[model samples]
Target: MNARGFTEEQEEFAAAVRQFAAKECGTREQRAVLTDDNREQHHDSIYAKIAASGYLGVSIPEEYGGSGGGILEQVILFEELWRGMVPVHGAGTSHTVAGVYKRYASEQQKKDVLGAICAGEVMSISISEPGAGSDAAAISCKAVRDGDVYRINGQKTWCSDAQFASKILLVARTGRGHRPHDGLTMFEIPTSTPGLDIRPIRTMGGGAEVNDLFFTDVEVPVTAVVGEEGGAWRQVMAGLNGERIVCAAQGLGMAQRSFDDLLGYLREREQFGAPIGSFQAVRHRVADLAIEIEASRALTYDTARRVAANEGAPEELVRATSMAKVKVTETAKRVALEGVQLMGGYGYTLEFDMERHLRLAIPATIYAGTNEIQRDIISSTFGLRPGRS
Candidate 1:
């Protein structure tokens, strides 16, 4: 293994991905042009190029025309992509969909969807609704069974990539179960469905990466149900391992990039006729950030390895992944903020990548099951319930 603990082949793959990003969207000007002034984080052309390189679905199997790598390879790809600041927004959701399809989708659906995804198509999962963010099971989006299809009608907010996604893995309530997580089912609906309306939600990031999807009598065939009629909760729960790992990997790469930029600035930026980094106070603060970044990496990779080793250990993975998600994302936010503070006036300007990094990092803690929710998951693993039992 290399110093970072990756095998020779993995290291070579990482280097190749880094070079790809450097050539595609490495510089600020190049990224600006590709992303249209930071407005399109998931630029179509750039994503198509990444697909052409066979890296977008690196975690998928070779039978699906993917790179035939595993979760670890996906982690490496995410780190290299974000470290080089490649603005591809579709990788995380694509891999998550790939995993879900592998386990639950029908044979025909798998053959079609997996091949499409590996061929550069984008897909998104809609679990959060207007009233359900942390309480995902609270989704009220209703899908009623008809003769040959399910007529869906509800509003789903914070649906990332819905505006551009080819298919949406939708979670809708079908009936009431003994518990909250029951009576739910997943549907694979095409974006072109007549009654499905997608409204973009613009954030400070200005990428329109997320959207509010409204389904008005949207009809999809019975075959659209992913795994079982009322087994959607199990399907979603089973995919959490890779989902949380994806978040942690993303934060790891972003934190490293922010720290690198800050250190470079400190070394060259002069104050009191000497480099600002030479000051004890500045040095100490930078040292703390460096430590935090390293700690985040260790936690992320360790949890990843453990999850791989104990593939089916759901309970252990729940605790480990929740902790990793919280730490990595929180640390990413802190590191980017610190970079901004260290750079002072220059950091906030659009000319620097720090501002963009901050934009990306700020939401890391909110999405993929918010950091607060993650903490609750971690604590629950210890037999400690947050609210009164």
Candidate 2:
């Protein structure tokens, strides 16, 4: 850990978050409900408690009714939140998007979204269009201005939590031609606006949490513009740095929890009168997992430092962030796989948490830019010669 990077105050914040996760987050049964399944039991009180605990808006500025904490505090909070498997504030997607708005949004825009975000009332971010998944610059959604309102027409898929989100942070084209990177813009459009429709897309793990949103002439006020009219590509690109960092943090937390579980299992399970931890392969696996996790943690925490310092996270850090996400997620997946393999039939059963971890880990490699995409990014950043070319 970077000792100088963490002050006494940050240490105390991390401790409190860990304690809260231990106490308030769901147990085995509750986790099954809060995580894998989509039960409509809106535990608003749980989020409220998180807010009252001064953690809901850890990274939002104090002027916006937050704790005025930095990215490190947020990393700590998320590490604790996901480590305990608690459903954190703003339904996942919104919290990440809100963090973007907090940093880049105009003063007024920040005030509009930050408070609702802290309260967990809104949840949305729609970068994935029907034809533009990894090719974010190829988005075809359009926002046409008329008087004081902009009429939106498009379809967004794989939008997490759009069904219940109060607002949708939409990106649409405001210009023309094949310059995929230019003339795009973003808007904070309320989900309840007329002509807006949301349908639940059943996912393997999260159940009603991800949705497909259809907009037909959805209207948003002029003030909804997040940045310059035709400057969304830059704005969206800037926000991705923070998004990758947060994703890395979440993956790290999951990896840590899986490692802890495996450690405990190895220490207790005996095979032929010797603990499993005594086996050479098991001992080596544990040691390797710990080392990989620590390396991922170092990269994630360093990215957070760059974000807080307002020093634009380097492309290398972006690559490192993706690398950490892929590495940590892969580590968790491997741990879960070996966990089941070692535990035999017990791993396949829902009575254990390893299966759920497996489900979650598979998606981490696919979302926030797939692991394949991350590899391409790293190669391009280093200007490595292409074999075919």
Candidate 3:
């Protein structure tokens, strides 16, 4: 009955997730306590709870200790979690890492890494460096191969959950090639590896969820390379489509939460002896947001289905997923800001969760890829190049 046409099983799954969220981590006060002290321990405990419920592997394969589901299932899982005001930083990145492993990792690597991820062990990816954020191909992290091992030496920025991660999916330059992206390679390295330094980056939202990672002579076995040694460009690009879809799902969930909170406030807060929702201006704005949210949801679901149907078609998926990312994230940012505005001074304070929602939504537009990059991807799909157009 929902806009996305969820099947009976999907509906039941979503309901189960909602029930878990309500019973296990409900209320702003409860979640605040969980996030306030010993963040790494709290995050581990929360992830363990989620893993114990068998929800962590919704999109993973059964052979790898997953639930044998597809991308749409993952989108549903993330959307429901965000709607429940759950912090999805670990879960989202973990899923992306799992997806990459499933596709490009060696058989042994898949068995080890994917199973650990499904069991709630966090594994972060290091792609963005000081010199490269959106331009992943420009990564300067060097991994010099020496007989049976590779010595990694470089720095990575914006590596979320690096402090608590057991391993990191690292991208580095193995050798100089014909193109900027030609020399790249991927590896799975343990966080405890020697010469790997992790430093937390505090945000305005009062959380240190991201970090800067410095790798100096961090050695890994030759078998650690993912996919082809010099073919990481295709692997990275392929993974981005899935990442975008997940980001879109996060945006959709946050937007839905903001809309719900705004509507609740409008219905409860009275002005001139009537609910503020009775005001035509307020009603119209809510209506507009609702329309945009529905549109974003539709696009996101459609793109997920497309990705599921076309597994290896990276070029085709790029356009749809980029559009989904742009629409859903922009909608989330807009909805969160408006929710704060609608609630007046109460929304600005930490007492109300609206401000927190805004903090989370603003970053979605930047991470995964900026909205501007998404627009460019969409245009490129239509044969429009930067100079030619």
Candidate 4:
């Protein structure tokens, strides 16, 4: 079903994506893919095909070789893609990161990166250092300018999909002070650059999607700087705002999918000669899940509208994003957990997608800033300064 209030064009796009997912992509055995390079190769090849089909750059401007659609279209695409299990869901994170380059890159830089990204060349943002995490400004990765190049030295952890990324949107400190946010700069660092090392970090999810990125004397030309020197703090903030909204879209999609699965199980599974869905407890829980999903969708779409229209996001936008992420992702986790519970032994088995949805939801609270940090962002907005009156 189309999102409430979606335009006809958006509905048509959703239909198109659903049709593509079902007919072309087929069902995904994502667990098997995680263990084998061949599966990843096949996955990337599929992404390249999608990129060629012109849907990969859905909301990017036409000038940048994108469809120039708004974020509402993007939201619909995410929902449909997740519903379809089309295998390119995580790749959109790279495309979203490319927005920083599109907005802040010089014309030549934009031409170079945006073109490659539109063609499905993978790039990832490297902002989370071991010491940084949610307090991103506290990143200690240092970049020292030397003539035409900036030499970088430090380690970045939790670099998603680094094993496959072609380039990294690297954030480093160019100036020194105790102020964490000051004197930061962003550069497009090719992953193959000398002195850059990437090693996969194993996790419960089994995807090896996160990595440790080490840079020692890695150098990028001055031309690689995305925006003005030392202006990266604000630039990254803007990109992050957009990132949170995009993440909320993903979270909403996963939640919806899990809820749908749960509903199906409840309708079909028999308990005491009656469908589980006939139970008051099960029905009430399902209704609550539906309500929460709809609420999350509304907030996410509203935030997308503000971003796409170039309007200043309300101060609450951050908290709103945080709320959406926290609620929707946690909701996804709940739905997945209870889905597994309600489905009995089958839910815990590898044969089901509910477990994978649970794995995916676990990381959502950690990425794009953790839920605890999100609460801080929300609390900081209330102006709790003492004696201000």
Candidate 5:
């Protein structure tokens, strides 16, 4: 590791990404045009530029036309982009789906799926049905095995970027087993598959990125199954844990940005004929926030280091990741809220980026397993159970 616990190569790569962000969407106006003045969550023109920069393949292996980097590089990309205010909403999901394909896909599947992703096409995960948000094992989306294919019929909600993605990583129940988690399978299905519908869900965040995906008699070849047919529960669980660091990286960046904006406001905004930061109470609050942001940075990078050192994380790392996810995300939300309160009406306006930060931070706690779930995981790892120590 080099400066700030990143390797020298990673540091250089982050500088390059920062420069790319500065050149592309460095200003709020540039980002606004890319996102159509915040009405859109994704823009093809900007995303095409990002793909051309090869940042899309930062964590993907080189064999499949990627940059052959690892988790750390992906974290840098995510953190720097968010810090620079580059709104590539699809990058997170696409990066995650590549990991799935890398881990479970057959050679041909990797060549096809990962190739498309590296080539600038995006991917979305199809989990979280109407009844299966937290309890993913309760998935009711059924994919029954037909003669030569599987016929899928169900609706998946809260699927991000499904409308614009070239592929979707779907989790559908194929059978029943001892536990609800068993007998589920993962599938890679093209977005253009028959009997599929994508409907945009208007959210308060002012983006049409999330959607509901409907499948009626959608048929996929039996070969589309990823990993074992009846063993996707384990696959999905590990995958979620693995992606926790990604969220932490993103949250840390957001929190830092919020604090930076707040600090500048406190220094410049005058009240009682002096800068508000000159007041002891305001100074104390700002100091507290600074400490919290620093703590979040430490926790996130320390967890990343442990994960990198382990080659792969042990089962215990689940709790570590859960802790990092909750701390970073909750801190990010708090910073945004505090920034809004301190900046008064200015923070709430579209003129400042604080409201956008708040919009993005609010969902981090709820999605990808809620903060409550993260705490539960941490507690359970401490041996908490029904009538147990």
Candidate 6:
């Protein structure tokens, strides 16, 4: 009966998350303090609050220190958090790493890693390299097995939250297979390991959320491997479904925030003796944006439910998740831009947060695989293939 058809339990959980975000993370000033300097103290303080609320382990197994909920719970939680303007830096990456570990990590690894994640420790994944962004399998970082250990070397770009992460889930080239996607292996390595260096990447949106990582012969034990050696492609593909869904949720949350802010501004800011929202053209524009937002929410929620139910074959899940990702992100970008335009001069100022949302939305379409790549995946699902002219 909720707009998106949330169950009673889900609605109650969302209410709790909304309360938490309002009390603990509501203001831009509060978020600024929490994410400043990319320091561990701020990250820990905020995430500890979240973990205490039992959100950090949603969708993970109870035996592994999680709440044993389904993925839809996570989608709901993230949507609420972002809608409240909470910065989801560390928790987002941690949840992603938790998903990978849930399926592939050894029992002991789960006890250690998943437990730490639930306790609010940040974990990052390094996949994209300088030469490989969209082409993930084209990464050249090498992880050569030497006896019982693997020596890792090379660099990774856009590795978000590495500065605060306790460990990094690294993907590296182990050997060549018949296809480029083969021979990639995943390893969990301590961020403090010798020869591993992390440098922050500053952005216009204003946060130390991303980093460039350089590994100079860093070594990890064979036990560090998450799944079968040389089988990371399959593992990564499986994990991407979760990634896309989460990204879609993030976009939807941001879009909702943008729309809410614009509506508030329109209602109060009068022009020519009447509220600007009373204008016909403005009202029509708002109506169109509202329609798009609802459409995006429906698609995202439906896809999330399918993911939770394991309702389809892997390929079908890929298509559904990709569609969600593409639609929600594009909708977010449009909403954020329109929000800025609606707010006029105030929108362009740092005093208002709409500009920040715009900056964040711009990158959403690019990261988590560009919308162009997502379109290709959707086409392939319909038996269409790329071809030469």
> Could you give the candidate ranking by lDDT, starting with the highest?
1, 6, 3, 5, 4, 2
Estimate the TM-score of every prediction: 0.97, 0.91, 0.96, 0.91, 0.96, 0.96
What TM-score number comes out for model 3?
A: 0.96
Clashing pairs in 5: 2-6
Q: Write the per-residue lDDT of candidate 6 for residues 1-389, one digit (tens) a residue.
A: 67669889999998998898888777767766776622222356767888877798887889878899888998998888878876667878888898899888889999999999887889999899999998987999999999999999999999988998999999999999999898999999999899999999877657667889999999899999998899998888888889999999889999999999899889999999999999999999999999999999999999999988889887899999999999999999999999999889998887777888898888889887899999999999999989979
What residue runs in model 5 are displaced by over 4 Å at the alpha carbon? 311-313, 386-389
lDDT of 5 by residue, 288-375 (tens): 9899989988888778777767634465788888998999999999999999988899989999889988998899888778999888
What digit string (tens of lDDT, one per residue) describes model 2 on residues 1-389?
34736788888888888888777764676655554453331356667788777677788788887878876787777777767767653445766777668656789888878877776576688889879999987788889999999988988888877777788888888787467688788888888789988998766554556778888998888889987888777777776666766677778788887777767777888888999889998788778778887877787787678776766547776666666667766766776677777666766777777666666667777877888887887777787746893
Give one clash count per candidate, in the order shown: 0, 0, 0, 0, 1, 0
Write the residue-wise lDDT of candidate 4 on 194-313 in tens digits: 999999887766456778999999988998888988888888877666677767777887888888878877889898999989989878878888888888878778777776776654
Weakest ten-residue segment in model 1 by summed lDDT: 307-316
Candidate models: Cα lDDT each: 0.89, 0.75, 0.87, 0.76, 0.86, 0.88
Q: Which candidate comes out best when scored by TM-score?
A: 1
After superposition, candidate 6 runs with Cα above 4 Å error? 1-3, 35-42
Against the true structure, candidate 6 reaches a TM-score of 0.96
Candidate 6 has its poorest 10 consecutive residues by lDDT at 35-44
Q: Give the higher-lDDT candidate: 2 or 5.
A: 5
At residue 349, candidate 3 shows an lDDT of: 84
Q: Which residue pairs in candidate 3 have backbone atoms (N, alpha carbon, C) closer than 3 angstroms, thus clashing? A: none
Clashes of 4: 0
Candidate 2 Cα outliers beyond 4 Å, as residue runs: 1-5, 33-43, 89-91, 310-313, 385-389
Q: Tell me which of candidates 2 and 3 scores higher on TM-score.
A: 3
Per-residue alpha-carbon lDDT of candidate 3 for residues 200-257, written as tens digits (9 for 90 to 100)? 9988656888899999899999999989998888887778889999999989999999
